[model samples]
Target: MNLFKYWKKDVPASLVVFFVALPLCLGIALASGAPLFSGVIAGIIGGVVVGLISKSNIGVSGPAAGLTAIVLTAITDLGGYEIFLVSVVMAGILQIIMGLLKAGVIGYYFPSSVIKGMLCAIGIIILLKQIPLVLGLSGEMESDRITFINFHEKISIGVIIVSVVSLLVLLLWDEVLAKRSNLFKLVPGPLIAVAIGIIIYLTMGQSGDLALNQSQLVNVPIPEDFNSFISNFTFPNFSALNNPAVYLTALTIAVVASLETLLSVEATDKLDPMKRQTPTSFELIAQGIGNTLSGLIGGLPLTQVIVRSSANVMSGGLSKLSTVLHGLLLLLSVIIIPKLLNLIPLAVLASVLLIIGYKLANPKRFVEMYKLGKEQFIPFIVTVVAIVIFDLLVGIIAGLIVGVIVLLLKSYTNSHSMLIKEFEGKKNLYHMNLAEEVTFVNRGSIVKELDALPQGAFLELDFRKTKILDYDILEYLDEFKVKAKNNNIQIKIISERGIVDDPHSFREFFGHKVFKMGH
Candidate 1:
């Protein structure tokens, strides 16, 4: 990393990613029923700490929305926020152990179809999640702050206008303006949208119902002094280490966090224009360190988030510097200019996410997948549907199961290929060729082909390329001999061993114990 070479690109990309990350951190914390500030802490640690150590060039880490349910349940069951932090710390330790054990190989097993499906599913989720926000369904009035925004009575007219126009800005930048000049390329669309949003808030938000509500703006906690800032973070209950529930929750968080991280790493690699592969094991250690630090300081457990990574890629972030810079920006924003940051509208950020979402789930990608045929398309579509209906982990497992079944079906059909020859002066002759390996699972396929043979036909069974022949297949061949004789069919068998006069001679030719051996 010239580290210095990409400052021009990374700076703008970092700003865009920072804005994208802020709401996510807050929202995920809210969903988890934890202090909203904890999400922000995790975001900062994930970016600055994990980003510093991770081998992945473009991946960005944060508190994942996927882990919200687990966090919520664990927090409730474990007694309180302080108790939950113990589990988070223990989870980080387990993750580090996994990394040392080289368990990262599992990341490679996911097929491209499933990976693409996950990316698209996440994109769709982003688009859907932002709809209400984009419409400015804010909650807080003048007096107090609200945890979650609701889509109740009325939508904001100002919010709608700002979202629409900001979305248009994003669209025009990507599809048209960015290509025309270096200036447009230098200024990220999200940053421009934010600036415009701030202007709108200042100009139209002095005093009226049309003003953006407190919930509609960024709401980071502002501390007056160092001691007060330190007081904002909650510490873990060390005594909870004795509880078995703590270990169980730790196991859950470690497993979920590791898996989500690997998935995001794979997806990020696919999205990278440079196509850099992250060292999965090393990445795990990085995440473990970040989580441990986050837990110690009373923050939510974190994972590599695909949405932020995709935003980084979309914004032209060229190095890990972008990841680090985004983290630094997050830290500075809450302390340095919390008031100024609050002026930024959530609707503009929603518009930014909506554009990134559309690009990920573009219709053209679906057409491309379909063109690859059903083997690829089926799992791709299934993963998308599963993720949309359920959650990330379930969707991936569903897709993996479907992918394997499709593979098995292909293997079954591909057991053998046949060629038929019939001439005016000769008998109808059929040649059946076997693949390199045949197993019991191919029984139905072979039976179907054998039963299709016509009466009085001369049949040639070729197994020269075969390396392994299962005993069940030999038994099936012996059974076929009886039918061949009944139909008055002449049969010849060929293999590396030699051509056999009797198909049933296989019993004597290949000993029972030798059936499993490869030629």
Candidate 2:
């Protein structure tokens, strides 16, 4: 395909995504206990491999922050990173099997509200998790930062100064410069912030405020030789297949990674200018392959990351080729300039992520959901708070449980309110009670009760107590009107207004119908 035509837009997008992906790859690796380069390897593979395979218009894959906890736990529980790697590989294989079986539709089982909650939660989690990194503190000290500022002896005022200042600057730039200047349209705000951060870091290094966080530096292990590079790759400890820990780890990875990927794919599609739907089944298969490959090679587990994907869309990617190119850049960077990468400060990278994190969890998003009404807000807020308190996956599960409960509750309440009673001394007549308001959610039950009337039967729909009726139910009634006419069944709608005849879908569905409440 003619790919270069879109390169003008895609290249800038890839660069922005590259910067965004850089820290996450490293931070997630640091969080996961894998060598930082392994994360980079995963990013490359995710972009080049999964990006190429994905049917999504704009999704970027890489080492997922969501997997950090699982990876850390797996490493210790399974006895080593190598053994955990085995589970990851096997997890990939499982994903492949799931894809082949069309299990991707499992994503559809989740309500849209729950999925939105999941994303908002991740955004909050990203912001919280990065605070320590932004301040140059050790995420190594506490994987679970339940309470704010545990200060587990790793906090430094100097680091905090740099982090807070960097975060503020980044935030200010995103708000002021990004909106105020046309410069940001041509050159990204993050790029500008990074350049400024590097200068500030250099200035601080010269003055010595940067020393406390020096240990938090990005380390891309220098490969002494091709053999050494090859040797660095860790293979799965397939022997651990029988181990309960390994199976659990694999299942955890498959489930969490799949959810994140599916939700991200959905969110990314919403952001797409073209609005072409991503094939969830195909996405699972692609992610399965990417994760499998990552696990096989000494790399972190992968997911379709939205931060990078948003950058891709904002930058103007025409196809998946832009994603592939970004991966290649990541690969080339590590191979050619591993040492130069070390020069980039963690604070600078954190600055980039802070901007992205804020964008994802923006306060405005909450307002938008609230505007949609309670049907959307409860799940959204639950997802956000849960992710902030616990982590990504747990928060999503919590939101989903809440969402499903609310759904069932609504169903039960509506079902209970429905009125269907047989008319006394009238073998063919049946009386139905109507609620104040009816919508599509209760359409099925209403239809089922109405359709059960015997052929040649007379039916009376009593809306005397009903204030409002849903259009969907009316549509169903119109269909049944034809059925009643053919089967010699009489239909009567008795309402406070008057008695009404058949309503057609196109012509008179919205007009007033006759109904009489009192005899």
Give the alpha carbon lDDT tens digit for every residue of 84-126 in model 2.
8888887887788878888778766766776666656555655
Candidate 2 local accuracy as lDDT? 0.72
Q: Write the per-residue lDDT of candidate 1 for residues 83-133, one digit (tens) a residue.
A: 999999999999999999998778999999999999998888777777777
TM-score of the candidate numbered 1? 0.92
> How well does candidate 2 score on lDDT at residue 235?
76
lDDT of 2 at 296: 86
Colliding pairs, model 1? none
lDDT of each: 0.87, 0.72
In terms of TM-score, how similar is model 2 to the real structure?
0.73
The true-versus-predicted C-alpha distance at residue 20 of model 2, in Å, is 2.3
